[model samples]
Target chain A: MDRGTRITFLAMVALLVAAPYVLYPVFLMKVLCFALFACAFNLLVGYVGLLSFGHAAFFGSAGYVTAYTVKMWGLPPELGILLGAVTGAALGLVIGWLAIRRQGIYFAMITLALSQIVFFYAVQAPWTGGEDGIQSVPRGHLFGVVDLQRPLGMYYTVLALFLAGFLLVYRIIHSPFGQVLKAIRENEPRTVSLGYETDRYKLLAFVLSAMLAGVAGGTKSLVFQLASLTDVQWQMSGEVVLMTLVGGLGTIFGPVVGAAVIVTMQNYLAEFGSWVTIIQGFIFVVCVLTFRRGIVGEIMGRFGPKGAAPTGGGH
Target chain B: MFELLGIPPQALFGQLLIGLINGAFYAMLSLGLAVIFGLLNIINFTHGAQYMMGAFVAYLSLTHLGLAYWWALLLAPIAVGLFGILLERTMLHRLYKLDHLYGLLLTFGLALIVEGFFRNQYGSSGLPYSIPAELRGGYNLGFMFLPTYRAWVVVASVIVCFGTWFVIERTKLGAYLRAATENPTLVQAFGVNVPRMVTLTYGFGVALAAFAGVMAAPIYQVSPLMGANLIIVVFAVVVIGGMGSILGAIVTGFGLGVIEGLTKVFYPEASNTVIFVIMAIVLTIKPAGLFGRAT
Candidate 1:
């Protein structure tokens, strides 16, 4: 990593480690979970240039799976999370398989449509508890050892998970595979002419992104101790998009900052009811029209060397 | 008197009519989307919110302004269309040179603003819009009873949809539109004002959605949340039909609505999701959609 990025990363970690002592651990954990989710989403949109509007399917379905397995099946929290991630990857496989057949706007619409099916299923399925959702999920012991029921314990565990997911995303972006993904994003026809199976690469990136988003959702359900329809709603999908856009579309740290900003805003604006939606929508308009570089991207462009900034993933 | 597959004809026909009514809305909405996408190349994510606005305008005018349904039918589209023109001019026009996704995101944000504003003004609960006196009762056909309003919706939407299709497919204005879609610079060089055309096309599409919403206000609850879910279904219809053909969009919208209704009759559990399932099946077999050319 570059010197600036490394220092920024260390500072972020240090602040996160110390954050729970001052702020509510539950709220911080929520930010971390969303940060992870946004990072995963960035893998597709930022690097591969594939925008899947249906990411809530992976995130929420994973939440449901984690909730169900931990609460009903009596599985430990770790196992439940693993199962949730697996479910996410499985869903990504199916959704990505179908969605990659089309590109651009149609791809977004297809994913949205498919995810709506998941939303409907969640609504009707007997296990999801319909409107109430799978509630009162047990946090469960971490591998029969650590007591995650404690606030600090849960906070640290979530932080650890977030870091791991964050590093994995960083690694994926720098890898040869990631280069191919970027190449495809920049010019799919050229990448295909270079003998890369662009679809396979795109599909793999999608699955990985979905899997990480699942991890975030799974962790979130445990933190909240409930899995509800709110997680699976199309609005949830849009929220993540807003988070990613506001922070910075392609930057590694952008989604983290974005998630933190959005989550914090929601926390503060909880009392305002639908005004939050209006403000968020306003931000979306402003961002698309004027602030496409986003907070992190703009910062990087100003301070970093010429031509080195991500600048909203090359577009 | 007879039963088809052990189901009473009354029940079956009633559901079919309901499905057709739904299909009519779908046809109109998707037709609007297809038209907008064809020229603008941006999926109007705010299309749903615009639809909801149409219903709201219709409802509010009745209660607040004492404007009746007929006036709402006239004014709502004009009001919503003007709003769409404003959006296109101020916001959407700036994004024509960028990736189309920005347009989607911008519109999505606009949708949130509009939906949120309405939700703030009127709570999530639906406001009632009574059927007009001219179309309140039902027609007792030989096999079943069809609500007059519902029948009128089908007839109105069909006429509107075909009228749109005919104008686009056969008229001089449509020829210019088609040429512009293929090559805007060339069309512009041919002395046609293309930007004005784009703005009007967007306005017209938004107007069509409002028209559907107004038509739907009485039949369905004029709720803020109504268009949100319906828009997603229409998106599925768009995918299944593909954006290639205007007629395709109309047919797929209506066809899927009927199929959804059939699913409701046969398997009630799958009714809400039958269209999405069809989308999956269509993507598997024909990714370009039934009517879309492979891009």
Candidate 2:
């Protein structure tokens, strides 16, 4: 790794390691889960240039799956989280298969419509418990060893999962497949002429992104011990988009930063209720109009190499 | 008293009428979306919020100013259309050169702002919007009783939809719009004010949504969330019909509404999701949509 990236990584790890002692573990865990979710969302939107607006389907459904398995089927937390990730991948496969048929705005809309189907199912399905959701879910023991019920144990477990997901995303972005995805994003018609199946690349990126988002959602349910309609709502989908957009679309560290800022804001402004929506919308407007590079992107542009900063992947 | 497929005609026709009424709203909204998308090249994500605003405007006018339904029908669209024009001039016009996705994001943000403000002020519950005296009550058609307001909504929307189609397909002004959609630079080269046209088209499209909202005020609860829910369904309609042809939007909107209504009769549980299911099926078979040419 470059000296700058190495230093940033070390600093981030250090901060995270020390965070639980300084701040509330539960809140920190929430930020980490969302950070991972944003990173996963960034994988497709930033690298592949495909914005799947229905990502909440993967994230929320995974939460439901993990909650149900751990609570109802008496599975371990690790196994529950794995089931959640698998559910996300399966959903991603079905949704991605349909969404990849179109590009750009249509892709966003299709994913959104399909996700709404998932939302309705969650609302009506017997297992989901409808409006109340799967509440008071037991976090259960981690691999029959670690006591996840302990605050520190749970925090460390969540931290480990976040770091693993973050590294996985970093690896994907640097891989040969990631390069081809970027090539497709930069010029799909050219990529097609070069004989690469652009659709396949897009779909694969989508599934990976969804799987990771599921991981985040699953981890989040364990942290809170609840899987509610809020996670699956269209608003949650919009929240992740806001987080990714605010952090920086293409940069690896951007979504992490974005997620922290947004989750923190939500924590502080929890009592303001609907004003949060307005403020978030205001941020969205400002970001699209003036701050499209996002917080991390702007910082990187000032300090990092020229032309290294990722564009918004415009078509 | 006759039954079709073991169901009474009244039940089937009742659902069908409800579907047709819903189809009217869909046709109007999707038509607006198609028009704006054709010219502006951005999905107006705030279209739903604007529809909600239309309902609110009508409701507020009646409650505060003592104005009636007819006045709201006349004033709501104009007010909402002017707001839309202002939005286009100040904010939306800036994103024309960037990716279309930015436009969607901006509008989505705007939608949140608008919906949030209204929700903060009025809360999420339904606000009453009584039908006009002229349009109250129902017609006994032997088979099923049709509320006069409901029948009027369908007729009014049909007239407006056809009128928009006529203008776009047959008129001189529409020729310029069609030309602009094809090549804005060429249209500008021909000395037509394409930017003004773009702004006005957005306003007009938003106005169409408002018009639907005003028509919808009495039949449905004039609630802040009404548009938020309907817009997704309309998006699916846009996907199934493809935004290539104006008529396709109208046809698909009404057709899907009818189909959804039929689902309610045969299988009530699927009524909410049947449109999305159709969208999935359509994508698998014809990715470009029913009327859209593959781009």
Candidate 3:
């Protein structure tokens, strides 16, 4: 990472650690979960150039699985989360395999159509608890030692997972596989002619992205102690898209910043009621029309990639 | 008195009628989407919201201005289409050269804003739009009671769909539009104002949605949430129809609506999901969509 990106990431870690004390820990956890979710989504859209509009299928399904395992099966927290990730990977395998056959807009539509199917299943399926959703899920003991019932304990667990996922994304983006994925995004035909199996790379990235999203969803279920249709709805998928777009597509830490801004905005604007959606809509229009580079991207653009501005720059 | 596949004729015909009505809306909306996508290459996510807006505009005009249904029918679509034109000029025009997904996101946000504002102002509880006086009652046919309003909606949609198709496929104006879609720069070289053509095309597409919205206001409650859910179903229809040709969108829209209606009659549990299931099967069998040419 560049100097600016490094400092920014560290600062975020410090701020996230201290946030629960000053702010509501639950709210902090929610932001972290969403930030991670946006990052996972960005892995496909930003890096792979595949905009999957139905990501909520993975995110929501994982949430349900984790909730069910912890609440009904009484599984350990780690195992429940693991199951959630596996569930997401499995779903990603099916969806990504089918979606990769088409390019661009068709891929998006197919993912959306497939995700709707998942939503319908969740609605009718008994395990999801129908409209009520799975509720009162036990946070359980974190690794058999940490009492997750405590806010700080839960905060740390979520923080660790977020960092791990974030680092994994960073590593993947910089790796050779990541370069191939980027190549696919930039130009698929060229990548294929160069002997790269572009579809396989896209599929792998999609599955990995889904798995990470599942981690966020599963953790969210434990953190909020609930899983419902809200998590799996197209609205949630749209929110991730908004977060990623606002932060900057194809950037590593942009999603985290975007998530923070959006979550903060929603928190402050909670009293404003429905105006939040309107404001978000306005922001989207503005961003697409003018600020396509997003907050971090703009900062990086002006500073020549040095990450000079501590507050606005990448690092 | 006889049964076909153990289903009563009355029930089958009832579901079929309901299906046809749904198909009408689907055909109109998807037809609009296909047109916009063809020239603009942007999926109008706000199409649903615009449809909702059309209904609301009609409602507002009727309640506030003492306008009749006929007047609102003419005015609502024009009003919504004007907004669409303005949106294209101000916001959408900027993204014409960039990734199309940006347009989708921008429109999605717009949808949220429109829906949110409506929800806040009107609340989620849908208000009823009275059926027009001319099409108020149902005609008791031999097998089923056919409401005149519903019948009008289906017929009107079919007529509108065909009219659009004919305009695009037959007229000299349509030839220019098609040529523009294939190569806007080339069409511009031919002395046609392609950019202005694009703006007008978007307006026309959105107007179709507005027309459907006005039609739907009576059948479904005029509510903020109406378009959000309907758009997803329409998206499924668009996928099944393949977004290729105008006729395909119309046929798929109506066919899927009928299928959904049948599902409601036979297995209400699957009614809501049957369209999506069909989309999945289509993707598995012909990933390009039924009417869509392989890209």
Q: Compared with the true structure, what per-residue lDDT tens digits does model 1 show for residues A220-269?
A: 99999999999999999999999999999888899999999999999999
Tell me how candidate 1 scores on lDDT. 0.94
- Give the candidates in order of TM-score, highest first: 2, 1, 3
TM-score of every prediction relative to native: 0.99, 0.99, 0.96
Residue A73 CA error for candidate 1 (Å)? 1.6
Model 3 achieves a DockQ score of: 0.55
Q: DockQ of each candidate's interface versus the true one?
A: 0.78, 0.81, 0.55
lDDT by residue (tens digit), candidate 2, B40-126? 999999999999999998999999999999999889999999999999999999998888899989999999999999989999999
Q: Is the docking of candidate 2 incorrect, acceptable, medium or high quality?
A: high
Where does candidate 1 chain A have its weakest 10-residue lDDT segment?
A306-315
lDDT (10s digit) by residue, model 1, range B122-163: 999998999999998987888888889998999999999999
Q: Give the better candidate number (1 or 3) by TM-score.
A: 1
How closely does chain A match the true chain A in each prediction, as TM-score? 0.99, 0.99, 0.95
* Segments in model 2 whose C-alpha atoms lie over 4 Å from true places: A313-315
Better of 1 and 2 by DockQ: 2
